[model samples]
Target: DAGVTQSPTHLIKTRGQHVTLRCSPISGHKSVSWYQQVLGQGPQFIFQYYEKEERGRGNFPDRFSARQFPNYSSELNVNALLLGDSALYLCASSLGGGNTEAFFGQGTRLTVV
Candidate 1:
């Protein structure tokens, strides 16, 4: 049994570029969510998807998007990146939605210059 797993543990991108981060939730789980963590701050929820549909979104701009697949894997996509976008992108999965206990991945560290 494994927890949530994210891909490409680290990445570097330029401003105005696009980046796609991947995640695969634990077996038998249906809820997948994405979060952004900057140094000195807590993780901010970005998007949550359950059963392949988006259930919620955070205060982020339109440049952020995500989707869950039938198998419960997900991808977080960011367009028109900015320096502010540099942070650790975390993926979490739980048995259900909101406030439920979730398992998180190590996260993909993105740097935009």
Candidate 2:
């Protein structure tokens, strides 16, 4: 089975612009979650979706949002990007929500200038 994957291993954007990151989860998986990891810090959960419905969200601003698709893939969108938004955008997937173990992808490194 294919594992979770993220596109554009790295990205460079200017402040005030918007960016979108993509993800594809493993086969048979129905849950996808997004996280942000700043330098030297653990990943912070951003959003989680199961069966195309939002299941959980973390302490992030409205500028950060995401959605899961029927095929179990997902996309994270960040608007009005700021320099602080520069970080590793991670995509994780699990069998289902709750206490399930999640698999992470390589991540998209976003750099805002």
Candidate 3:
């Protein structure tokens, strides 16, 4: 079965533009999380959308948001993008919320020019 999948593998956007990145979790997984990985830094947690409850979000600005669908897929949306937002956006899936083992996708690399 597929572990986790993300779309568009690569993207380019301009400052002030808005972009949406999509993710599909593994079969039967109910929780999805978004992370941003900048060069030379670790992955920073962005948002977690669970099947049954609200999990948590990172310290990102209001421009960042996400939603989980009934099918357990997810989308991360960023509005008014900035050059600082250029990074690898990762999606992870788990059996449930909290510290469960998460399976991650290769991620969508976003470049804000």
Q: What's model 3's TM-score?
A: 0.96
Across 1-113, the per-residue lDDT of candidate 2 in tens digits comes to 67899998999999999999999998888989999999999999999999999998999999998988778899999999999999999999898887368999999999999
Off by over 4 Å in 3: none
Tens digits of per-residue lDDT, candidate 1, 1-113, equal 88889998999999999999999998988899999999999999999998898999999999998888788899999999999999999999988886468889999999999
Worst ten in a row by lDDT for model 3: 48-57
Give the C-alpha lDDT of model 1: 0.94
Compute the lDDT for candidate 2. 0.93
Alpha carbon deviation, residue 70, candidate 3 (Å): 0.5
- Model 2 regions lying over 4 Å from their true place: none
